[model samples]
Target: MSVKRLDWPDWLLSTLWLVVIAFIWWMAVRLLHIPEYILPSPEQIVERVSSSPTYFGAATAATLRVIAVGFMAGVAIAIPAGFAFARIQLLEKSLYPFVVFLQTMPLIAVTPVLIIWFGYGLVPTAILVGFSVLFPVLVNTVAAVKNISPRLYFVTSSMGANALQTFRYVDWPMALPYFLSSFRISLALATTTAVVGEFIAANAGLGYLALRGVRNKDPVQVISVVLIAALIGVLLNAASVLVETKVLRKYRD
Candidate 1:
C-alpha cells in the first residue's frame, strides 16, 4: 500500500506567523512607550537600517561572503573525511577522539590564534567560520554512513554492486538527509563565527558597527546592528532550509 503524504502549506503558515510577529512587535512599541536608546521600536530600527543602505549593504555582503565560503569549504572537507573514517575502522578509532576534542575547544579561546595566523582579513574570518562549523558536518556524516543497515549492504553485495557502487547508491542516499541537517546547523554556526571573527578583529562589518555603537554609547545603533545581524542570520538559515527542502523531498515521505 502507498503511504499518504501529508501536505503542509508551509508558505502560508510562515506568512501568517510573520504577520502575527509583526503585529506583536508593533503593539509592544506603541503600547510600552519604550525609549529608543533602551529598546528601539521596530520603526526606529527600520529607519536606521534604511538611512545608510550602502554601508549596511556592503557590511552584510562581506559577512555573507565569509559565511558562504567558509561553510562550503568546511562541508567539502568534512563529508569526504567522514566517509573515510566511517569505512575505515582504524581511521575512525584514531580520529574520532581528536574530532571530539576539537569540538570541545572554545572558539573564543582560539580566535586570537586564528587572527594571528591568518591575519585580520577575510582569510581569518573564513577559517574561523570553517573551524567553528566543521564538527557538525563531520559528526553527522560519519553517523549517517555508519548507520546504514548491514542487511542492505549484504543485499547490494549479492546483487554484484562494487564498493564504489554501494557507496554511491546506498551510503550516499541514506546519508543525504543527515548531511543536509548538518548543513543547516553549519550555516548558522558559520554566520556566528564570522560575526565573532569580525568582533575580534575587523575594520568593517556589522560586528564592527556594533563595537562602534558601544564605544559611542549609542544604544539605538547598537540594537539596530544586532537586529540587522539577527535578520541576516535568519535569512541565511531560511535559504538553507529552502535548499534542504528541495534536495531532501524524496526522503520525506
Candidate 2:
C-alpha cells in the first residue's frame, strides 16, 4: 500500500524553513569558529535584540510613524491624481513628465535637499516615503481607468448618467482593484524609503540604529535591525492584502 502525503499550513512550512536555515547557520558558525563581529549567529542576534528591546522598540515606532504617514498621504494623493491624469489628456501631457522625472530621482539624492528644506525631522522623512509610494499606485490607477471598455461608458451615457455618476458606478469599482493591486508594492516602497530617509536625516529609526551598529562594528546589532525591518515589511504586506480583499468585497457588492 502507498502512504498518503500530508499538506502543511503555509506558516508552518515557512517556520520550518526558517528553523532549518537557522540550524545550518548555527552549525556553520560553530564548525568554522566564526567571530561574532563578522557574522553573528541567529541566537546572538536574538540575544542582542532582547538585551535592548526598548531601544529597538522606540526606533521601530519612529520608523513606523514615517511609514504610516507616508503610505496614507501617498494613497490619498495618488488616487485623485491618477483620476485627473486619466480624465484630462492635456494635464497628463503637461505634468506626467515631471512626475516621471521626480520618480527617476533617487531617494538618497532627494533626502539631502529635503533635509535642507525641512531640516531633519518627521516631515521630510514622511515626504520622502510618500514620494517613494506615489508612482506605482498612480500608474496602476491611470491604467485601470484607461483600460475600461468604451462600451460601458456608452451604456452609462445612454442611460443619461452624468460624468460623476458614471465614475461612481463604473470607474471607481472597476479601477479600485487595479489601484489596490499596487498597495503591496507601495507598502514595500514605504518601508524601504523610510529606512533610507532615516539613514540620511533622522535622529532615531531602525536605519539610524543600523548605522550605529555599523559605527560600532557590531554585526549582531545590524543583523537584528535588518531582521526587524524585514519582519515589518512582511506584516505590512500581509495587512495590505487583507485590506484589499475586504475593500474589494465592499466595492463589488
Candidate 3:
C-alpha cells in the first residue's frame, strides 16, 4: 500500500489563516486601547500566564488528569455499550430513551447533587466529566455501527466469517472514523466538564483559579483563565483531529 503524503499547501494555508487572526487580535488590542481591567491584550494575558507558571502548571495538571481519566472511562463504557445497543434491538429499545434523557440533563443541576453524594474531590469531577461526554460518543458509535454497509456484512457472512471475524475485518474499520469523530466532540465536552466540576468545588485547577479571579474582581485574570481553558480545549481538539487523520487515512479517498 502506498503511503499518502501530507498536503503542504493545506498546512501553509492554515498557517496563513492563524497569522491573520493573530494580526487582527493585535490590531484590536492596539486600536481599541482597551483597559487591562476590562480586556487585557493577548500579550498581557500571555505574560500573566508565563509569570504565574507555578500556579497555572498545578492547575493545568489537575484539570488534565481529571479530563484524561474521565474521558477514558467514558469512552471505555460507551464503546461496548454502544455496540450492544446497535446489535440488539431490545437493548436499543430499552436504553436509547434513557441515553437521550441523560444527554439532556443539565450538568450544573447534577453537579451539586454529585458533590453532596461523592464529596468534593477528583472522583466527583471525573464522574461529572464522564457523564457529560458519554452520550455523544455512545450515540455516535451506535449509529456508526448500525449504519455499516449490508453488502459488507453479506460478503463476510458468505465467507463463513464468525461474528468476531466480521467485526474485526469489516465493522471496526468502517466505524473507526465515526468513532474518532465522536471522540473529537467528547474531548472538548470532557474539558468543559472538568472546568465545571472544578467550579462546583475545588481548591485547585484552572477552573478554581477562574472562580478566584471572579471573587477578587480581577477581570484580567478571569479572562486569562478562560483563554487558557479555551486554548487547552482547542489543542485537545486539534490533537484528536491529528489522530483521526492518521487512523482514517485509508478511508480518505
Best by TM-score: 2
What would the per-residue lDDT of candidate 3 be over residues 30-80, giving only the tens digit for each residue?
A: 998867777777777778889999888899999999999999999999999
Error of 3 at 143 (Å): 1.2
Q: Give, for candidate 3, the lowest lDDT window spanning 10 residues.
A: 6-15
Candidate 2 residue lDDT tens string, 140-212: 9999999999999999999999989999999999998897789899999999889878887898999999889
The TM-scores, one per candidate, come to: 0.87, 0.93, 0.88
Q: Which stretches of candidate 1 lie over 4 Å from their true place?
A: 1-9, 250-253
lDDT of each: 0.83, 0.91, 0.86
Query: Which residue ranges in model 3 land beyond 4 Å of their true spot?
Result: 1-23, 26-30, 250-253
Cα RMSD for candidates in order: 4.1, 1.8, 4.5
lDDT for each residue of candidate 1 in 135-158, tens digit (9 for 90 to 100): 899999989998999999999999
Candidate 3 steric clashes: 0
